[model samples]
Target chain A: LAKTTQPISMDSYEGQEVNITCSHNNIATNDYITWYQQFPSQGPRFIIQGYKTKVTNEVASLFIPADRKSSTLSLPRVSLSDTAVYYCLVAHGAGGFKTIFGAGTRLFVKA
Target chain B: DVKVTQSSRYLVKRTGEKVFLECVQDMDHENMFWYRQDPGLGLRLIYFSYDVKMKEKGDIPEGYSVSREKKERFSLILESASTNQTSMYLCASILAGEDSNEQYFGPGTRLTVT
Candidate 1:
């Protein structure tokens, strides 16, 4: 399992773009970068995932550098409902992969 | 949509009491996971099962055990509950092989051990 580091908290305003970066210096080659968002008491929901470069979905975008050392999650036009903790994890596919989620970046969207 | 449901949303137990946390997924996924979340510490894996009757210990498995008798259900057992074991318990499931990009999580059960 690869370890990830992210900001403890972030402040953002409604309609602003929010980007949270996660560092995984020891990331593995076969690993993929995945992001999840968790509301107050709800379980984390899958946001976006990417192996390299950029991957975009209806909710967010994931950007990974060529070195695979770090990645960023970009949320466009944030709203108060988007206030939650975001987690980034590096994991492989299949066969009981034990994923370790670090202390996620808490995003507080203000009106 | 893949649905993961836990047995309870909240629970209270006394010390030395036996506790059981149940998780069920409707997606026919081959992998299920149990994790405990606490303040400061992020989600820590307790155990996981890739197939029926097969189990694997995760990062924090001490004082905890798991049982997977069927493919859709996974159970986490606490033989003797302790106060320190009080925390939010979560259940997750994912598909097998490369398509397992993300793990779907349950609503979680906040277990209080007194």
Candidate 2:
């Protein structure tokens, strides 16, 4: 499993684009980066995932450079409801595996 | 869409009591996992099962056990509940193979042991 580091907290205003970056200096070739969003008292929801380059989805976009050591999650036109804790995780791609989550980046979206 | 349902949204138990957390997934995913979440500590895997009757211990397996009698159901058991066990428990399931990057999670059970 690769270790991931993320900002403890971030603040963004409504209608602004927010990007959260995660660093996995020792990420493995077989590992993949995934992100999840969790509202208070709710389970984390899958946001987006990428191995390299950029992958975009309806809710967010994941950017992974060729180095694959780091990745960024971009959320466009944020709203107050977008406020939540975001987790960046790196783990093996197949079978049953588990990875530890870091102190996720707490994004506080304000009006 | 994958639907993972837990038996309870909230539970209260007394110390030394046995506790069981049930999780069922409709997608028929082969892999099921149990995790506990705390305030400062992020999600910690308690146990995971690859297929029916086959289980693996995760990072924190002490004081916890799991049983996967069928492909769709996985249960987490606490032999004797304690106050320190009061936390949110989450269940997740994923399909087999590399593209199984997305793990669908249930609503989570908030267990309170007094």
- DockQ values per model: 0.70, 0.70
- lDDT tens readout by residue for model 2, A1-111: 687899999999999999999999998888889999999988898898888899998999999999999999999999999999999998787643876577789999999
Q: Which stretches of candidate 1 lie over 4 Å from their true place?
A: A94-96
Quality of candidate 1's docking, in CAPRI categories? Answer: medium
Q: Taking the tens digit of each residue's C-alpha lDDT, what string does model 1 give over B1-114?
A: 779999999999999999999999999999899999997777889999999999999999999999999999999999999999999999999888855468999999999998
Say what the interface RMSD of candidate 2 is: 1.6
Give the backbone clash total of model 1.
Answer: 0
Pick by DockQ: which candidate is best?
1
Residues B1-114 of candidate 2 have per-residue lDDT tens digits of 679999999999999999999999999899989999998677889999999999999888999999999999999999999999999999999888857478889999999999
Q: Which stretches of candidate 2 lie over 4 Å from their true place?
A: none
lDDT of 1: 0.91
